[model samples]
Target: MISVLFAILTALSNGAASVLQRRAALAVPDTQTMRLSLIGHLLRQKVWLAGIGLVIVAAVCQAVALATGPISVVQPIFVIELPATLLLAGFVMRVRVPRGVWYGVAAVTVGLALGMASAAPGGGSTSVHGAVWVPALIVTGIFEAALITGAMSTRGNPRAALLGLAAACGYSLTAALMKDAMGRLDDGGVTALMTSWQLYATAAAGVGALFLLQNALQAGTLVAVQPMLTLGDALISILYGVTLFGEELRTGWWLLPELVALFLIALGCIELARSPLASGHAAPPRRSTRVT
Candidate 1:
């Protein structure tokens, strides 16, 4: 129960932080590629640096939440930021969110809640099957490379979808690794992320995920990009739990809710497909906000 509470808090913070990052991104002048690179270049303007800093902070909060919670509880809530972000954009940023988008958000939210509620009840645990980190890192790297190559070759919104897929996979891997590392700890709440190969792998995965997501954002609208990323992350994390961690679905009849979740996910994706066309009218005009 405490874990779930922390997870929900983390999810809300993550959502707000993402909206801040997006707002900061909107204020920058460079093209998406250049903006991405420039974010790392401290010599540039404060907004770029601030955006990067805020994203890093948000990520840290997410990691802390995962350290304290079950992946089943944490991952689903983390995924909520996808739809919540769009809603925030609508209300806070003054972006015009579509009615379909709200419906999709509700469906995705309900589906995720149902899915989480249906996760097999247990105290959190993590175990690595083989080498602590080397193999997972290598495989995730290869996967990220393939995803990037595909994203580069693909056209338009499909490329965005592919990138979202890649980002979600990366995030799922990162979460799994983080949970595993956290389980290895005994005393201090903080594990030295540097000492843990799992953490390094997670960091590498995060780099690729962030870059891929940025590219996706460039290719599509915020409403579209965010929801697809969220859904993909949830799906991949669920697979990891079942296939990798040996977590079970709640009932003998688990297939039904799984199917329902898929249906809602598909409907959400359809709504997202129309988002790029809607962006010109959806994005809010630039407003001044301090980045502290």
Candidate 2:
């Protein structure tokens, strides 16, 4: 229950962070795309700094959730971030969220509850053999590379979706590394935690995730990216939980409800993506000063 609470809080924090960070990123000059200098510029923005602070909070909450619960259980909860982001973005942009959007949000919330209840994921081993890391990393790395390449090769919404998918992969990998690091901490002391390769790997994956997130935000509308980000992370996290952490979800009779829940969630995502809250409007043009 504690882990579940933490996971929900993490989703809220991450959703707010995404909105704030994207707002700041959109304000940056277009010429800064894909450059390390982009980070330097964003660092100077107070809004971006606030977003980073929220990101740190979200990370801490996610770590606690992962330490206390199964990865399959914790990661799926993050899908709420999509609805949360839309709400936050609407508030920030001073746009009223339409009634239809609320219906979509309701679908997402209910679908998530039903899906989690039906699946009842449980029993995971955090400490896997070192040999497991090689194949897992290699396959994930290849997939992420493909996503990044696809993102860079396109423009507009397609590019944003691709980058968002890459970011999702990076975030899922980071969560796995974080779970391993927490397990190391439990087994060993502070020294072991500091020395664990998983700790450093988590940090690296986090940085990569942030990089992809910013790029995705710059590429197009949040509508184009958010669904891919949320769904990709959940699906990839499930895969990681099963393969790397030895977690289990109910099968057979439970599968029917799970499939239904997934359909509802997908329907909600489509509706939310089409909502006015997600299709952000352009800012009004600034008036020019005339010297007579």
Candidate 3:
């Protein structure tokens, strides 16, 4: 329950940050994208700075949630971030909420509820078993490398999908590492937690994921990036929870509802991503030299 609460807080904070960041991104020139100059352009805007603050808050909340609960329980909650982002965007833009967006929100909310109830995910170790880290890191590295390679060979939506998948993998890896790092606190102390290699690895993985996500967003439409990101993170996190942390979930008959729920969530994410407000395209593209 502690995990669930913090996870919700993290999702809401991240959703709010995304809306602020999108507004800032929309106000900037397209030429600045995928470049270091983009950060400089954004820093001039108060909205973007506020967004960065919220991002830090979300990261702290996420760390708390991962430390206290099973990864399966914590990660799936983030599926709501997309719907929340769009809703916040609509409000910020002073645009009326579209009927389709309402429907998508309902679908995602219901699907997430139904899925969590059906799966009843729980009972995972806080830390991975001994000697498992080596193989896990090796496989994850190879997988990310392959995705990045594929992304380089493609353009547009294809590239976005590949990069999104890679980002998903990175985020999942971060969560696993974070949990392991936090587990050290129980075993030793704060010093042990700070000294753990998992602590440093978690930061590295998070930065890598953020970088891939930025490129993915810039590569193509949100429709291509959002679904892969939404679903991929949930699925990959579940895999990590089960394989690395020994988390358990209902199987056999329960699989039916879980699959159905994932489909609904995916549909909702696609619909939400298609909205102009959600894509930060509702406002006309205006590149102003002065930001005030």
TM per model?
Answer: 0.74, 0.81, 0.90
lDDT of 1 by residue, 45-98 (tens): 564455456566666666666666656656766655556666766776676677
Q: Tally clashing residue pairs in candidate 1.
A: 0
Weakest 10 consecutive residues of candidate 2 by summed lDDT:
277-286
Q: Could you arrange the candidates by TM-score from highest to lowest?
A: 3, 2, 1
* Candidate 3, 210-266: lDDT as tens digits: 999999998988899988998899989999999999999999999999999999999
The lDDT for every candidate, in the order shown, is: 0.65, 0.87, 0.91
How many steric overlaps are in each model, in order? 0, 0, 0
TM-score-better candidate, 1 vs 2: 2
lDDT of 2 by residue, 48-77 (tens): 999999999998999899988888999999
Can you tell me which runs of candidate 3 are displaced by over 4 Å? 25-45, 284-292
Candidate 3 lDDT trough over 10 residues, lowest sum = 279-288
Residue-level error in angstroms, candidate 3, position 120: 0.6
- Pairs with steric clashes in candidate 2: none
